[model samples]
Target chain A: MDSSSLLSRVRVVLCRPSHPGNIGAAARAMKTMGLSRLVLVAPRRFPDAEAAARASGAVDVLERAVVVETLAEALAGTVVSVAFTTRSRTYVQPFRTPEESAREVLQALQAAPDTQAALVFGNETNGLANEEVWQCAFPATIPANPEYSSLNLAAAVQVACYVLARTCEAFSPQAGAIADAPDFVPVSHEAVEGLIAQWLAVLERLDFYDPAAPKRLEARLRRLLARTRLERAELDILRGMLKAVARKIP
Target chain B: MDSSSLLSRVRVVLCRPSHPGNIGAAARAMKTMGLSRLVLVAPRRFPDAEAAARASGAVDVLERAVVVETLAEALAGTVVSVAFTTRSRTYVQPFRTPEESAREVLQALQAAPDTQAALVFGNETNGLANEEVWQCAFPATIPANPEYSSLNLAAAVQVACYVLARTCEAFSPQAGAIADAPDFVPVSHEAVEGLIAQWLAVLERLDFYDPAAPKRLEARLRRLLARTRLERAELDILRGMLKAVARKIP
Candidate 1:
């Protein structure tokens, strides 16, 4: 479960796969991307000759896959559980993309290095049911053709693996040249709000806010600042500049 | 639409989507990520009441989506077409991860100032079929759990948009604060290849190859050089060194 170790970092969990071919293809896809850990939850048919044949040289992955009866058992020890859902269920929480989910997973891994994480995929027929999605902390969805949004189960695994691999590659330990000198620390939401409030006060003092002038002025300011992604230091500087301007106004 | 005006742009394309709720969720995903453009190709059911209700507040993306019958139509006039696939199709060439694909898309947009570009996703049942994947210039595949790789469609779009947004945010128009004064242009790929070949001849004369050594040596050399991403001036210096070594060998 060590975040630093490549193994035990991520576990791919399929709720219930109907086709053996998908399991095989999923294995192949995982191997191609340098990922091997796989877990199946009550597969309709696994260890089938067809799946083994389709798996190519990834038979090892198939051999090592854990078969469990329920999702709860599969995710028992995992710190983060991300459910893959195609539709937004009435009661299920909203979704994030695999990339965003990966970031979250990475953060969780860093925060609690011993906790394992699982990215769960549902059955082939209906996908992870609403109940399954609700069990997870968040749902991740793949955007597909609105007319025909049916992606093969294995393909979903491939996408998730690709995200993890790329993330690992982009921020590889060897590529940690910037780690020593962190240029900008992200400003917390509270800090950003404080800056905004300060700016608003200055604007109010200068009579900049015209009640009837615009409907979305505050909203626009929020959007603009969100896009900037200012660092804490940068926000502090802006606050100082605003205070200086306020002093001059007197 | 002018691609330049679409700077820091994001286009959300859905292919063969079956559930209307998914379409709505996709719109919500786009809106959350600050992406406005949404395109749909041959959706099974759209503008469904369920989709609008699920969209929460991102109805604008749904209302504005450009619906088309075919993937080709959706990608018309696009300078760069990136197909998001989870399965490795027999027909299409190797795929890049979302990050690499996004980099290419951004680069293509910058290179061809006015050209339109698109990121296409496939159906839910079967991601961009093999033929569809081949139509794209760049193929992006996500990495998932090998055992059960089922990712919800909207999540794929979210990942794509997230990478695009981050790339746009990270891009620095200017090279460095203290731009290196214009120096000798770097040698092109062809020039580098020629220099490497000449260096190989010198090594050959020095008995550096023991019949099987050249292959390994060349691979190591390629890996070392590829890491540098050498500019014109840097390449010139390397070529000059190679030429000097080659002359001395005689």
Candidate 2:
């Protein structure tokens, strides 16, 4: 599908996954592209030891995964369904490429805000049967090397994720996209330095630091402030607290 | 721990997390506050059915989690480790509140760049044992509602994530921190108005605006530029080009 239609409101469904690792990887793939919903249908081993280990720290996804008995159960009340398949079939309904399928799904999503759209993939050994392919409005196929189109479950998910992430339009900031604008009032370098100086003055008055000694105390305070990157409001609060401390010290 | 020492250099680690979903959620929490580098010790389950479903879209973190076989493996080279435990210890090394613990971790991270410090959390059923707590330099207890401290795994992660995010000094543009003053130049509203007026003059010369009736062209341009809070350098470039355009307009 075109880039704009792949993000925001799509769910990736796995039917009878034999290996839990693939489920974990698929979840990871979905997250990288900002897609979250994952539905599993009749998995052999779920909450399995191997799956959790492979999922690494992504335990949240596993805890929330919905386990079901059948594809129909998984697709209950879904507005649109797109099936991912490798083999071409002449008897069944026409299948669209991933791009075309994504476009269709995107249109359906826009049309029906309340409805859910699912992209379904079958198990490792054998893919969805003829009936399952026919159940989908359109089949979605990933274009790969013609010589070897055997894509792993997670890899396929990643491809779909990449396509969808680019396609969807959302107001949220893109990953690593930093707008170079002065939107907020900044605590200027000069202001921070002044605050530090005032604090040092108080320390001196209280005889907390030896005047003859090296400027280690000032350097330490500077480093602390610099590393924290304190905001204007935060700095103001800190300065007020320091002043209070100074008042009590005398 | 003192406030300065409490917040020096901090790392948050999840131990034996049973669900991948929680891992994904944990990553989301960490990313929201600009914390990275998650370590996973021998989890009961990984890459499983439930995790992918629950993580929603935070898969990148799952993909990047450093998986290890043992707690020792996870803590191998770290200079300090804070085990998150809910259970009270009678005779263990001193325990600090989450605030104090967070401060200490933050300090360690800052004091010795080479020293790896971590805040470790145990499994779902039971938290880190006394022996496990003793493995670390200090024990950290989160001050929750007195009656209920039974925080969900992801919720615990979220709380720790928030503390680290707040305590750390890294100024992210996304977080609206003015850490890197050198990188940006602020542009004022008046400067933007001046540029627009100059542009309108050129448009008038080019007969782009109707003389008989005023069009909404300037309004539209203003709307577009208003959304973008330009840096000082950007304003200079735009104004410079506007002047060059005005010189050539005749």
Candidate 3:
């Protein structure tokens, strides 16, 4: 689940940026969120003095940034193109809250494991064109104040990248501990429900309770079962015992 | 849960900043992420022209920034103070995931709803002193590539502010939509366990199943409860049913 490798697959694409300074700031923003890939689609200025100056110490991000002639060129090999749109759009496009969008991004990485994804941002003043928004499979919107929802392009990138980084499964001391610990992930609800039905059959064969007066017994059992937080392997073991007991009966 | 109001209550405190440019960049970084309150503690240089140049158009954020003599003064009126550190520490300060720290910061805001909180970042070169870190209740470390993890002061601010902004409840279109949406929070696991123990007591008397051959039954039951993800009211309803069943058995 460690996502640093997955994070490497995420490209922060700034489309047709007007200000060199915003480009620089966006580079710094990307690095902070552990996102290094910066693909610029026809930015008005690149390799500009203003950009280098504004990049602060994250000049490396700018230096390594990929500048392409067109948005299509920028998203060449990318699978999921997510647009970071500011204004409300009449255009039809799949949308998700930034948090949920981050999850989707992670899942994309999880699904392919090696394939890449792109997060596209439109120009500062104009935002995304309807055509550009439609090009994306997913569009993520940041929840800012409606009255003054003026988030700078770099800031929008910062928020999205930040959520992606924060949501990432880091292989740090904390994540390492969680992985090493025996707190195995619990089994699904469907699996547990199936196990419960099987157990009921075994109980009926054993004459444990009169089936006619089972009043609240099954519900009580369900509630008790719900509390254990059982792992998949533990569920398997329990199911095995149920099968064994059922086989013993006539 | 648009947290713009809650964000304003956050004080981004920098202790002993050596460079004025970093202060400016940090201000810009904060503003991008919707965090404006800045407190400089014993900075080596303040109100310098270099800081203004670096701040870009976010000088308004810097113009309104606060400067104090000590970290204590910077943290004035702040009940929950978090220190951001880079190096691994053997010290006993409580550590939290940035996500968790943001939650704690939000809770502090909720506890008072009007009072301010602080996220304290260390100096550019040397980071916070041991004594300074101990002053804060929680400490959070960003998971970065250890090989070249020399994140600039402004970049650190950018990451932290981005996380805070992303996790906030903004009054924007998407935020309103999320707030209006019903996503019920489940009851705590401990509360579920206590109810199960009470039910087990009655089950013993009712001669439910073979007590001698528990046979992973209790384990299976616990798993089922965990899967239910029961709400408090549902737990209450089930507990009432358990009591009724116990009475009938006797």
Candidate 4:
């Protein structure tokens, strides 16, 4: 399935959220990761100015958000649900890391074209209730500092959405592809050999290399050049320095 | 070699952040993920109430944050730095996704134990200036929605720190390990066979199965049960349901 279609099928359900600004921030976070579906369950205040203000450019997401009275209604028709929690609950299966949860979420969506998934988050302070957590199919945790695992509501949403986007390839950029890096011309062995020769000649002129007692200095220079992987530009700089010193040698 | 030691070596550099709340929020984000080193370059305001209130429980991170006059000062001792940019700049190599950046950052840290690494963020309105980006060894992009790629400063920090934490295993929880999951007792072949037999018997009593022309129903049911890898508790539930159905039939 296409990333957008799959991502669109995944609902971000916020249960009993107290702050309107967080709701706005969550909307912005979701939209920024190409996730548009938002479900608010029992929000203390909706249509608040703070939410709209915090939402910034994601007003459309807030406008289209589905506000429900309960988590059950928010999660209705979702084939699977993963609850984000910091606490360890024994009833639920092993908690998934965010990356694992993203993979599983995408896998489930791909496994069934019509099936929908829900990423359920709880209140800022109380988090998800045990009963509410039980309603979800999976329990996921964002591994954090043992001393301070409390992530702000919107920040948590951003991390989850970011992981999901990356896992699903919602964005097309390759992780490590330097898309605009200059075209690299591989340095030939001949060029390296010439550069080494020039370097040796310069060192000889500077009395750093002695013809009478060579002492494996040339061999060591060759090894150092090979390890450095000199680029053409870098090689030019070295050559320029060598020529400048050779001029002064006379 | 340890996660905390490696994580501590990473510096979260905010270049000319516009808002103090974002500064505080970034501190909270970093601390939650076990990243404590925060360096601010020319922030509009520091030691502000909004920042403190937003920092919430992560005041220590703020208290210890290093404020510098320039990006160079913030990155002085760092062996390598990655500038976060949303724009496509022709000057830098391909933009790294947060995950890739995290792996590379950790790899660089591991390769040189004494070296430090920086994750640089630009101002809220305009991302990393071209000159600032050029100063860093690597450029990274968050792989956000093309339409709305603007992640608030703290959100970006959260994603980066979260990725780094996960990559370095700063937190002890394994990505997929269910530390608190109940010990799974594997179902034996005999147990599976017994459950299948009981299920067939119950089906026969319910008129759902016929022994005279067993039409592959038992075979299909057996195959289904084998694929399920039913847990002991699940097996017991099935048996109790089957027994209840048989009792009703009588």
Ranking by TM-score: 4, 3, 1, 2
Interface root-mean-square deviation (Å) of every model: 21.7, 24.4, 11.1, 30.3
Model 1 Cα lDDT, one tens digit per residue, A126-195: 8888778878889887654333445556666766766766655532323322221144466799998999
lDDT of candidate 4 over A1-250, digit per residue (tens): 5688888898899999999999999999999999999999989999899999899999999999999998767766665678899845554256777888887677656655575788999999999986677666667888889889999999999999998888777786543211222332224344666787887776666556677898756644543343333445556655654564455444
- Highest DockQ among the candidates is held by which one? 4
Q: What digit string (tens of lDDT, one per residue) describes model 4 on residues B1-250? A: 8999999999999999999999999999999998899999998999899999999999999999999999999999898899998855675377887778888888888888798999999999988888899899889888888888889889999999998988777785653355443734557899988987887776666555678989866665564455445556556655664554455454
Task: Please give the lDDT score for candidate 4.
Answer: 0.79
Lowest lDDT sum, 10 consecutive residues, model 2 chain A, at A171-180
At residue A158, what lDDT does model 1 achieve?
Answer: 65
TM-score head-to-head 2 vs 3, winner? 3
Per-prediction TM-score, please?
0.43, 0.36, 0.62, 0.78
What is the full ranking by lDDT, best candidate first? 4, 3, 1, 2
**Best candidate according to TM-score:** 4
lDDT of 1 by residue, B28-68 (tens): 65665456677899899986897896565677678888888
Best by lDDT: 4
Candidate 1, true inter-chain contacts retained: 0.00
> Model 2, residue A243: displacement in angstroms?
52
After TM-score superposition, the amount by which residue B139's alpha carbon in candidate 3 deviates from its true location, in angstroms, is 1.5
Per prediction, fnat is 0.00, 0.00, 0.17, 0.53
Give me the runs in candidate 2 sitting further than 4 Å from their true place: A1-9, A170-176, A179-250, B1-250
Where is model 1 more than 4 Å wrong at Cα?
A1-7, A170-250, B1-101, B106-250
Residue runs of model 4 more than 4 Å from their true location after superposition: A174-250, B175-193, B210-237
Provide per-model DockQ scores: 0.02, 0.02, 0.11, 0.19
Summing lDDT over every window of 10 consecutive residues in candidate 3 chain B, give the lowest-scoring window: B176-185
